[model samples]
Target: MKFSYDYIKSGNATCVLEMGKERFEFYPTFHSDALGDFVSYLASVHPLCKLSWKEGAFHKINGGITWETGTYLLRWELKRDFEDLEIKITEWQNPMIDRKGDSQLIRKVLEAKCNFNEFVLCVVKELDRVIKQRGILGYRQEWQGYTFPIDGFLDLKYACLYKKPFEITKKNNGTSLEAELNLLMEKMD
Candidate 1:
């Protein structure tokens, strides 16, 4: 995740979440510089060590852990010990955000015992990718959503992705993930 925000405008940006030796990409509403701020939010929110820098890259930008069917599943790995954390699209909540239809998403996060700062990180972290290559969302991960995280209004990018259904070609592993996610959601419900 290299940042050239000095030249880049538009609140929209892309991110690669890394955990222990794994990485995953998600679309964010900010530039590359924002990735560190984003990761700091994760380190503070999730039970993890302090996230920092090792010269240029994130010291532990390695892999990600997402909640699929209530399980902390490891889906990808990183060049470093850490993997990228991801927002599985299977858990997108924009419909609910629309239903609430306001900054109610913010209130939702507060209700979940998250402070304002925490909510911001969650919002950024939960953002879905509009993969440029596919022009659609991909690999939805149904992670746990905090209580009123969506009430405070959302960035249009994240909000809009949820308003429509984005699917992938049948040949890719997309179908497998969709099917598996459906079963996971059913059992979770």
Candidate 2:
């Protein structure tokens, strides 16, 4: 497995995930509701992992997933109020009928494409099963992203307001999704 990170913003702002065989073409897209739904899913799977939403952040107890590298803590709380939210699940699958709950960020995370592999999609599919069978939030996602440092980087206590994200369409007929992200990266630079 390999790990690489790119800070989409300043500070220690980074998107870090372990990769092996697979390549991450873009960040996972999810709906705003999915964020809360993920919290509900965790409650069903891990009976002992106590989690809740309070004080504008999500909190959880000594909870984590055992990985070969180490015990990665699967806990974090958003610093920003995620209202007026917009999330785009890259795939067209409908979550309400699929049993993955209304907030479907997990599905997007599980379906993302990497350098030469795809595990995100499989993760989403299996997570749905785990949620159904165990009826709890048993899965532990790596703690990624932080708003505090990013806030400091921008010298603001709150994040900038933005509209719901939409799928950036491609201009050419043959351009793949990867190509779109590539173009986006180039333009960002």
How does each model score on TM-score? Answer: 0.21, 0.20
lDDT of 2 by residue, 85-149 (tens): 11122233333445553433322333332321122222233333333333322212222221111
Per-residue alpha-carbon lDDT of model 1 for 113-181, expressed as tens digits?
213333333343343221221211121111111111111112212222233222322554333455323
Per-prediction backbone clash count? 55, 24
lDDT score for candidate 2 against the true structure = 0.26
**Which candidate gets the maximum lDDT versus the true structure?**
1
Local distance difference test values of all predictions, in order? 0.28, 0.26
The residue ranges of model 1 lying beyond 4 angstroms of the native Cα positions read 1-8, 17-23, 30-37, 42-90, 95-97, 100-189
